[model samples]
Target: MFRRRPARELSADDLLTTLGRLTAQARAGAELQRARVELAEALQREMLPAALPGVPGVRAAAAYAPARNGLDIGGDWYDGFPLPGGRLAFCIGDVQGHDVEAAAFMGQIRMGLRAVAGGGADPGVVLARANELLLSVDSPLFATCTFLTFDPVAWEVVAARAGHPPGVWATADGRCGIAEENGGAPLGVLPGETYPVTYWRLAPRGAFALLTDGVVEGPSFPIEAGLAEAAKRVRDRAPTGDPADVAAAVMDVAEFTGHTDDAAVVVLCYDRADRDNG
Candidate 1:
């Protein structure tokens, strides 16, 4: 018959065995966590557009980088698609938090925005309607977004922001600056928020960049400094390459790995020759 031993009387072998079991359990837990992150990343990528739409007289491209550490998945997302009336719409947004819930919420928001924008409303009106839709949902997540509607025929763009980072615009002459316009509160925050639309003329041989906060706001950098750096990078690279190349170049210069948050960017370039000739 076996007798129960006192807690203090555990043998060295018993302690070693317990430690081994715990080590194995820890490794298994880590592996499971890694697998979850991978799955989340794949799901989030599905939410993003596989390729930017090919708009006449314009070149569009987008890039997304997941977080290097932590869950490797975030709410950052970018999308570009054709709208009615020969106009194109591009958007970038960031949902709160960096988990599966946030990713799911982001997907819903993107779909909602796309549906609302497709109805031919102005950028500001589309955002307002989107805000109302989000408020009607049961989600607790709030999101920041910047939406732009480009009219190739008029060579102009209208932009609206919901507490998101200002867009970067560069002219062919190398002049670059942030699109500082009046913006309303983030979606899901206040009901019936009115987002103001800012009108901008698209420069021939120029590019506009839209990015989530992860690209500009980091622990070591303030938003203003980061915005300046982004504008400078775009101005330096805007002289060459298409929108995709410019987007990649900007992402490289931004040093995304330095921060733990994911980054999403979209660049839209307009060529006067294409507009006039094509």
Candidate 2:
């Protein structure tokens, strides 16, 4: 058997070399993570609507902000479009988790909702059908969503929710309150859940808002408090302005700085002038 020589201890030079290599590896890993986050942000932006639809009897506006930490991408999304029967559909949703996968799932659910609504289904039916579609896909993620179909001709709005936050309703004279309704389980949670629809008369020159949790829930504030604060903000700013301006004003009150969750909002204003023109 050959005799083995004694092992020599690592010198400072050797240690320095090893540390340099480790540092380089860490830097490379961080760079790769940053690239992935950028890609996810871009993908999320691509999935959102470029502009909210302008219906004859309603003025609509939407705003979206991604997370400020980690991947900087979350499953918060908003959509508004005119349906076939001259009704306008507005939706806001937040999928579980903050990642690219959640965002992708959100896109699928939103498209499915639009398809079902286009078939002239009511808000409740649209959500029910969308839930079935998600189950068929076997999606592991679940989401909270609120859908509303506004019929300008009838001056009514039909609304449905799937574990989403209550919508804020404001009268033309600046009075505001939350419209609480019974909601079913979130989509992808139960195979056959029934969504209930609530009908409300649209107030002249009034507006309704759909928002994700990120807009209301924060570190220091509870959900109820946030809703109250938001309602006040809406009441103050919604008296006169375009939908877009109102949306911006409401979001400004949310104070998103240092918040971890993403936010999305959609404001639909029923101006008497628009109805008269239609």
Please report, in order, the local distance difference test score of every candidate based on alpha carbons: 0.85, 0.83
lDDT of 2 by residue, 77-173 (tens): 8888888878888899989976668778988988999889999998998999999999899878999999998887888989999999998878778
Candidate 2: C-alpha lDDT: 0.83
User: Candidate 2 at 60: error in angstroms?
Assistant: 0.6
Among all windows of 10 consecutive residues in model 2, the one with the lowest summed lDDT is 251-260
Clashing pairs in 1: none
lDDT of 1 at 109: 88
Q: For model 1, what is the alpha-carbon lDDT of residue 98?
A: 79
Q: Listing every candidate in turn, what is its Cα RMSD in Å to the true structure after a full C-alpha superposition?
A: 3.3, 2.6
Q: Give per-residue lDDT, candidate 1, residue 59.
A: 86
Q: What local lDDT score does residue 261 receive in model 2, on the 0 to 100 scale? A: 85
